[model samples]
Target: MSHQSGHQHHIWVQSHHPVKLEPKLPQPLPKEPTFYYFAYGSCMCPVDLKRSLGENTHHYVIGPSILQGYRLGFYVYSPTRKCGVLDIVPDPKASVKGVLYQLPWRLSEYLDKREGVAQGLYRHELVNIHCQDQVYQDVRTYIVVDKLAEEAAPNDWYFNVVLRGAVTCGLPEEYCWHLFNHMYNLQQRNQERQLRESA
Candidate 1:
């Protein structure tokens, strides 16, 4: 698929290749701490993820998760309490595929901060979000709460980052098309609702 600059953006996350910390954090144990990052709304592109996980992060591009009936919602940009997660009903038949990254202990710390993993905003959980016979083993991932961003819909520029990254992650053409269609519809609905609430 050709790269286009619009609703869907294309960001390249560089690999700085930083050294991993030998001594992990005392509280967040890494004894069997495996990193499993879910990339549904964004975080799909390896390069972008690489920036967060560094070059040594191991990942499996498994996705199309049901989100367990949870929908993708936007919070205030990032590093904000306004961030929220949303509800999207799950269809056992329909799969929302994305990427899953498994990083080392040191890398996880960096992501923890980036994703607000410490403030109890994003909780780490293990899930089996895959199609066919594929299943992730002991994959730990963090999830954001939808209600936080319920009122703060992401702006076009921020959402574009997700769109662009998803495109580069090798999402199937059909799925990519669906994303475009869904994003448009969601944008319109969000606007109308905002107007009504204000009125």
Candidate 2:
């Protein structure tokens, strides 16, 4: 008898199967030392902040906040960006609206580097921030080391980024409009000056 006839034969088939995997959930941020930061400029944009901080910053954002006793100004010229950047100036009657963050302490050095702290382009200023019916004290922000005598216009790139950050981070609609007008007026003035100089 044939060897196959000694026992009942069984056929085994193998088939490729697709796996059903559960969607991955975002991991919670690691517990670590953190610091409160108030961003009034390009840093207000999480997209921009991520570029420097080397990580996503959206999770760190608290929300739109008010910096009382201060006003926003474009008093610093960035040679790197080739435009004027925002700075906070003391003004008792004015308030600056900006994004607040509770960033990991590890990001402090990166933020400092981005702010040009070592180069003295900006220096840290400790202040209070009001957000969501709470006052956060001793929050760190940056100010120009040497402010220009007159405000300077931001380039189109800077202008767009500032406005994008303001809107994306949910700053007040009125404040966003005011910011837009302020930048536009400065740009108009700059264009007129250029035309006159070239003529």
Candidate 3:
């Protein structure tokens, strides 16, 4: 990894209509959830998984230190708040030097809500992440926005949190500056759109 080096495997959430969001995706029974949840956001703040699963939680955060090349975006929208937090998927090429929350076979309502699995915006799936000098395979978690939608734009608040976390997580400045640069570009684009729309 060159810069970014970390990723957001955690999420933002709301209500879910699984059938609507996942027309073809297979649904996994929560009862059989023996996989780990790779947390990259607030869950990364601590081993919240341990709280949710008691002694069942395993592994602290390990990483390829997912560096640059991923874009953090939002899935669920909060109409009343006008701005939602970061919860989108990271680019596959981008790395998420994220914490792995190994969860036991029980439903964590807090995580389910946080990732919006209950909400239609995301559907749970198993994906492998590179971490701890080896390849981690078949871990399960929810991915928001089935296929990233094309927008000529992106979100401001969402990007800030990711950049802040990555930096706080100890990612270097050149890499951090790269994120800020991306933010600057998005801000410019939003301003341009607003100017045009107002006109």
Candidate 4:
């Protein structure tokens, strides 16, 4: 675990977000079948992922990776989390940084359930990811079925989990700062809107 030091800006949130340490090296694939997964949202956090998959996922992580031709947006409200959640939108000039995993096929159904695939909230998107100087093809990721017209603000919990995963997984420092600032700005704007409406 590396920490971001000497940064001028501070993340303004009322709660403590803990980042649990995980093994950097991924476990070798089993004799059973496996599939590649790229996670850009709360799923990036192995702790949260384990909660859904019902198993330890840290060992499944293939580390921080990049996805080209797509950018992140908070385009859907999650009834479960009661907040806006992440989605990937096509953007030719943009790229998303996230965690990549090679997971056993047994966990596939759980993963789909977590993404609300059965309810049609999200659908699989096969993509190519760049990891450790190599390009991985036909990786599975989820995208919003119906995106909001405008971006929405993520709640503090979702925001923190995302940042924790990014930092813990060793994403680029500059990209992490950009993510922090983007979410912070959205939260601040949302708060302001709420205050104005209340007044």
Identify the candidate with maximal TM-score.
2
lDDT of 2 by residue, 1-199 (tens): 5666533332111112212211242433554689999998998899999999999999999999999999989898998889988999999999999999999998999999999999999999999999999999999999999999999899999998899999999999999999999999999999999999999
**Candidate 4 TM-score, C-alpha based:** 0.84
Q: In every candidate, how many clashes are there?
A: 17, 0, 15, 0
Determine the C-alpha RMSD for candidate 3 after optimal superposition of all C-alphas: 16.7
Question: Model 3, which residues run further than 4 Å from truth?
Answer: 1-35, 40-60, 63-81, 84-97, 103-107, 146-148, 152-157, 172-175
Model 1 ranges off by over 4 Å: 1-34, 54-94, 131-133, 146-152, 193-199
TM, every model: 0.59, 0.85, 0.55, 0.84
Give residue 184's lDDT in candidate 1 (0 to 100). 65
Show model 2 residue runs off by greater than 4 Å: 1-30
Candidate 4 per-residue C-alpha lDDT over 1-199 given as tens digits, one digit per residue, 9 for 90 to 100: 1234323223322123223212343534555699999999898889999999999999999989999999989899888888889999999999999999999999999999999999989999999999999999999999999988977899999999999988888899999999999899889999999999999
Residue-level lDDT of model 3, residues 106-177, one tens digit each, is: 546656655556556556656666556666676655555654353323366555555655555555567667
Residue 138 in candidate 2, Cα distance off native in Å: 0.4
Question: On a 0 to 1 TM-score scale, where does candidate 1 land against the true structure?
Answer: 0.59
Q: What is the descending TM-score order?
A: 2, 4, 1, 3
Q: Which window of 10 residues has the lowest lDDT sum in candidate 3? A: 6-15
Segments of candidate 4 deviating more than 4 angstroms: 1-29
Candidate 4: clashing residue pairs, number? 0
Better of 1 and 4 by TM-score: 4
Show pairs that collide, candidate 4. none
